[model samples]
Target: MIGIRSVVFDVGETLLDDTREWMAWADWLGVPSHTMSALVGAVVAQGRDNADALRLIRPGLDVAAERRAREAAGRGEQISEADLYPDVRPALAELRRRGLWVGIAGNQTARAAELLRALALPVDAVATSGEWSVAKPAPEFFARLIEWAPGAPEEIVYVGDHPANDIHPAKVAGLRAVLLRRGPLGYLAAEDPAATAAADWRVDSLADLPGLLSPR
Candidate 1:
């Protein structure tokens, strides 16, 4: 197996637990959790075409949908940057300790810096949708990552919970892809056999990351 040298992560579901933010949105919208769950299920049932899924969920929301959801809640409940993810600092630290270059690629707005500071994950570079004006599953974001890291594509592994956005495009971009199976979005991997097949590897927790990338 080719040894992995650099690891890039998808922020929302892969490293950050945005459940609180989602639930908060549901409460604000006066939509029940089950209703949102059903909507998400309906979207996933459409399979790997994320563009189709987004159309069904909330077309206007687009890449900034999560942030828009939080804003729509009207509770003055802004998402704290630090409360974004669980156990991220240690994981990033461990990767660095193992001598791997770390970076992040995801869809986000200007609030990305706040979110990163909140998670406290040590990332050498970041490519956000707001900055690029494009989202993942498109090669542009990953291409930006390559420019940012300037590392060999084969040595970079992209880890994310989304099949269409993260896993598929990383492979298309000539980087290895790892699916993170511990977040809300992880169910797609479980429900869709085809998605599971596309992933180079699957991890249940961020803590397992170090071992997965460690030299054999």
Candidate 2:
């Protein structure tokens, strides 16, 4: 394996806690938060994509319009810093201090990049699907990270919470993958040996990351 010189991350539950965002979606869809949670869980249990689950919940919904509305609302409302996980800043600082170039690449609305900037995350670069014109699990999305980071794909590590979105795609793109277990899909991935085995490293929290990626 090539030595790692850079690291990239998925934005959602990887760096930020998306519980409130999902709950907001539940409320906007007129469903109870628990009901929405159950549906998301069921979707994962069956090894189905979350998009399929959203379709099952509300077929024919105009997602793009809804996203636009959400972004507009976000612009007016201040997103709390508490939405970020406690370990994010320290872990990122440790990685950067160790000379690893850090970046963020994820599936998010156009506003997410602005939000991250507003939140003052200490990443070197940030790219969202909205900006890149492609989303994760897509070769283009992972490919963009290579363009943004300082090293070759094999010399980079991509870390995130989702098995399919973060780990699998990064591996397919020729980068090492590390699964951070804290998102909605993380539990399902953790229980599936095939998913866990696909990653080069699996840690319960970002706090475990810096040491795992430390130079040997």
Candidate 3:
């Protein structure tokens, strides 16, 4: 029960819904949307990396170049404000109103920051794995997030939907972890009796977040 001072969020499926983006990627890969969807589910079920799942769809695909092509065609990889959860803005606003710094830290691609910035979400900081040179489930990434927060790890709460990447690693980094029930891995984590207990907090939606993190 460390007094919480800041909240860091995972971008995809937590704050922003990427279902359309995934579907778009499926189209770009010349695969059926259902097929891509199933692959995503399988990846989560097997505890596999998402990149591996994409490679299964299109081996030797140049992911970066593909993204650039999409952008050039006006189908940028960034999530729009329309894709964001209904609860996201209010929750973030509440946190800032309560004097808590807010940020987004996730294992997103290079354009993540640009996309998030486009949404004009109320946050103090935004960062992606590509920018940090490290991805989640890694101590170094959390270290960078802590530095970005400019807050003591004990006083920060990392909110995300991934059990392995967000909850466990943030806990190991000495930040309180809050499991948000949205995204591919969220239900998967709940199905595991042990994994469900790993988080310091759990909420069904970001709307429930403000009350949970009120200074104790």
RMSD of candidates 1 onward, in order: 3.6, 2.3, 1.6
Q: Between which residue pairs do clashes occur in model 2?
A: none
- For model 1, residues 1-216, the per-residue Cα lDDT tens digits are 568778888877776666665565566556787776566556556654433433445556553465465656654334464555666778888888888888877876656745564555677766678777877777887887777764688788888988888888889899888888855468757566876888888888788888778532
lDDT of 2 by residue, 1-216 (tens): 336788898888788887787787787678889988888778877868765655777898777777667667763222468888899999988888888888888888667777777776777888889888999889988877888888888889998888878888889999999887787677668887977999999999887878778542
Please report the candidate that would top lDDT against the real structure: 3
- What's the C-alpha lDDT at position 178 in model 1? 87
What are the runs in model 2 whose C-alpha is more than 4 Å off? 71-79
The whole-model lDDT of each prediction reads: 0.71, 0.80, 0.85
lDDT score, candidate 3: 0.85
Task: Give the range of the ten consecutive residues with the poorest summed lDDT in model 2.
Answer: 70-79
* Location of the lowest summed lDDT over 10 successive residues in candidate 3: 207-216
TM-scores for every candidate against the unseen true structure: 0.80, 0.90, 0.93
The residue-level lDDT of candidate 2 at 93 comes to 87
Candidate 3, superposed: residue stretches over 4 Å from native: 72-74
Model 3 superposed RMSD (Cα): 1.6
